[model samples]
Target: MISLTNLSYYLGSRALYENASMHIKPGQKIGLIGLNGTGKSTLLRLIMGEYQLDGGTISKAGDVTIGFLNQDLLSYQTDDSILSVAMQAFERQNHLQKRIDGLLHEMEVNYRDELVDKLARAQDEFAALDGYTIQSKAEEILEGLGFSTDDLHQPLRSFSGGWRMRVMLAKLLLQKPSLLMLDEPTNHLDLPSIVWVEKYILNYEGAVIVVSHDREFLDNVVDSIVEVSGAKLNYYSGNYSFYLEEKALRNEIQQGAYENQQAKIRQTERFIERFKAKATKAKQAQSRVKMLEKMDRVDAVIDENARVNFRFNFSTQPGRHILHLDDVTKNYGEKKILTHANARLERGDHVALIGANGRGKSTLLRIIAGTEPTTKGERRLGHNVSFSFYAQHQLESLNVEDNMLEELKSANPTKSEAELRTVLGCFLFSGDDVFKKIKVLSGGEKSRVALAKVLLSQANFLLLDEPTNHLDMQSVNILIQALDQYEGTFVVVSHDRYFVSQIANKIWYIEDEQIKEYPGTYDEYEWWMEERKANPVDTKTAAPQASSNSNGKLADKSEHNNSNGSVNGKKPVSANDEERKEWQRALKKATQQSEEFEQKIAGLEKQIKQLEAEMASPVVVADGKKMQAKTADYQRLKTQLDSVQEQWEDAMLEAEKLEKKLG
Candidate 1:
């Protein structure tokens, strides 16, 4: 267990958090949340011993290894490949292995008995730590984080800074310290990679502390959220969504208390004033004045969220079909994203677009929004359908030299300086933060700035792509409430399931170059997916139903045979057509088998992903032995999967050979 007593951090003259205290036992995943500059990152730095506390003492039992994913990527430095960068986490293993190697080189007979025993012990320790599998483990972590096979051999210096941050995260997870403190770990990850990381965090055995804007990941991973507000750390025992509901109730109670106290004070003052002029009531009046003076006051801050209700109004009533994209096709050179895709979006539809990473959910939205054009077919927007797009890469648009307040001023000319600061405060930016240049801001801070800009845009049709990317739980809740009350249309692409459930009323699922709509919230969509699994469509039966043939033509078997050619067991086709029929059957079988393998692979991949996400939590890396074991298991499973994949691939090759033989 780790405990801090009256911890405080001083920033110039102001204390970001004063006398704040918290605790962590074994195996509890926690999320540290606050507005931008509310000391979340500072708190993590304090815990990691990177910064000294201004006041109060921190207590920890013996060596508690901490793996921190700092917002800044300067900590993990190497000129090696991405794989080598991640593998650096196994430094201790590498050190021990080196000693073992040196020992092996020395002749055993030439060495003293004591030297021989020491060498043997060193080798045993290295093996027990699973030092032998470091290379494979590093490769697996890199691949799981969306690194391509080519990227493995590619030097880390060849990658951009954002990709370098991913490599940094991969190292932290590979190290698997007792306490894992992640600051916006998912910022650079795509949907599939995010999902993979989330799954990894879930199965992690040690304690975890995550600082993220992705609500769905928190709801799935963290058991609690610690919110920093009013220069204090407030602990909430719930996930991101839970914290929102709880905070809403808590805020309501606070508001009532303030109102009631003010009302009583006003009544007391009135009575004292009325009796002041009367001689007989003078004593009572004086007594009342004394009583009033002695009364304790209820101090309450104004609710910032109450201010920025930039009511988005549709400029024009769109057609019944607000958007129509028929047989839309797109490709980047030979890499096809969407092929023969079709979809329709109507006015007032709260739609969510979802698919695996790099599958073009955002690209399709861009195509719909006209930021990008489809290669073929047409995407038509209804008359006067105005849109406010929130790109996932919003931070890229920010001017690095501009301060927070300046950015806001530039984004919305009509917004007053005071009003912009208040709005920024509501999103967790306050005081000097408004003066901080964009270049020095954290990923989460940049995300908030973008979101704050979007809120002020006042567009009726909102298109958001991963809007909850770098937020802590508290900010996400505030956002959820804001979106829920929104009366206009929303078309968002997010992997944050909780946020999607709160705001989306319909879903656009992209699969096999098709956009499928699930006309409900995330919960309803999930339920529908479950139903489909429980009652899957029988391909053999559904095939005939889906086939289109003129009824007049079907009546003639001769014509049908000329087109399709029947099999011998059912009906005779062309002479010597058995091989061709068998080929078709094999293809069908392979398709089914491939789908099944993909599903299994998906499930395994999901679990692995959860493990990565859990690694980002504050709990998993907070305990020594537990973190070590969790990481050991992660490496072991990765190896098992690789071996299994090799076998699976071989089986598939055999199946393909048989298919060719039959043909």
Candidate 2:
């Protein structure tokens, strides 16, 4: 547990947090959120002790380990495998195992009784630590984060930067510290991997503090939301969705109060100016002036100037059919992505293209945008259709040598200097930001520049792929709203469900080299999927094409489990009865081992006590040799007792694991 009291932090002259106070309770999961440059990462650093508080105090409970997983990956041995790096989380267990091995070797060489006792004690400590589960836990976490079984044995240095960060994440999760701090954890994860982490955090036993721009992930995982805004930390009792509603209500109330106070102040000042010099009304005017002076000014509910306002401008309108694709097939060597895929889009259609990662979503978008050619496909764009594309790679496509203003001008060469400056200002780039070189800009800043270019292009059609990758939540919402109101037709490849749900009027679901069209919002599509699961169709027959109005029928139903299994329907043949039986057997064995260790420990304790009583007798103390011999026996019994006790503790820990798994 940690508490921040009257915390204050400053970045040069700008105040990040002033008198910001909050408490992170044990096992509480908190989502830290705010606009970009609002010090979400800085607060995590403060909790990690990377930054010294300028004023105030941060108190943490004693011996509470904190696992902080930042974006950077610390260097490791070049030959160390990924699994080995993750297993380093069990440093204590590793050391104890080594000591046990040394004692085992000593016993093998000399066969000393003391050596056996030492080895037993060491083995007990290692088992009590659940040392045997380390490798499995590491592998499980790595796989959950999208690493394959083959990746476990690969050297850590062989992974790319993003994958290396995932390795660090696995290490942090395996550490199982008292407190876990992750900043932008989903930045590199695919949709499925993100879902895995969401479920993992929800089931985690320790405290979690994660900062993420993915609204849906935060909404699903965290119990509380913390907003770092207006140089203060604000607490919300519920998830991100709750925070949004509460924040809006709070702002509305604050605005009303501020307006009322301003009105009263204006009335008092006017009375004072008009009647202060008069004799009859002077007292009332003076009293009003005093009241005005004592009144506490209510701060207006205006966000800081650092906010992005997005609106797309288009050059021309497209025909009724914005885009059409028939017999679309794309292949990379032997691996086929799309096989005779067919889709149609009308004017003003907002479509979301979603599927698992590496499923040709981005490739399809490129093919549609004319950036890439399909292997065997007939694609056509409607007359007067002009589109702009934004991808992850486009963020780096900006000319590093050019400043922000120059880049904007190049994108929209017809726009004058004044017009360009105004556009940049709306995107939250002003004054010196316009002069900032592309090479020196941060990731978020670079994203804003790239987006600004897309907006400035004024294309009637948009082909965007992961447009919200580097943008903060506020920026994402702004884009969502802008796209919602835009007249142009757009096809977006996005993993942000929240953003897609808000902007998309139709869904493009891809699976098994097929692109199926579902007409409805993302939320509606989710509902339809649940209905299909609840009333499953036979795989033996041909699958029915999902109707456009299917979403409307299931839209109002409650959320359902998407996991593969049978509940209210016929039993699924995929159930693993053998695996379940094996797990039960393991649990039973662990419990029996724990009971046996307890009995052995109890017997050792009794023997040690008897030996102590015998050595303490007055008859043995009077005889020097007898006393010395009794003392030696007492020491031997004590050593054996310690070993049994350790064994008992280890068995108990293993039993606990089994109990949880069984439950």
Clashing pairs in 2: 128-650, 313-458, 314-458
Candidate 1 minimal-lDDT segment of 10 residues: 544-553
lDDT of candidate 1 at residue 434, scale 0 to 100: 92
Q: Tens digit of lDDT per residue, candidate 1, span 205-309?
A: 778998877767788889999888877878889888899899888888888888999998899889888999999999998998998889887667456453334
Q: Estimate every model's Cα lDDT from 0 to 1.
A: 0.73, 0.80
Q: In model 1, which regions exceed 4 Å deviation?
A: 74-79, 101-119, 135-154, 157-164, 190-199, 238-298, 301-308, 314-318, 332-334, 369-378, 385-388, 392-462, 471-490, 532-663
Q: Estimate each model's TM-score.
A: 0.66, 0.73
In model 2, which regions exceed 4 Å deviation? 74-79, 99-115, 274-295, 303-311, 319-347, 369-385, 416-422, 430-435, 535-663
User: Judged by lDDT against the true structure, how good is candidate 1?
Assistant: 0.73
Error of 1 at 154 (Å): 4.1
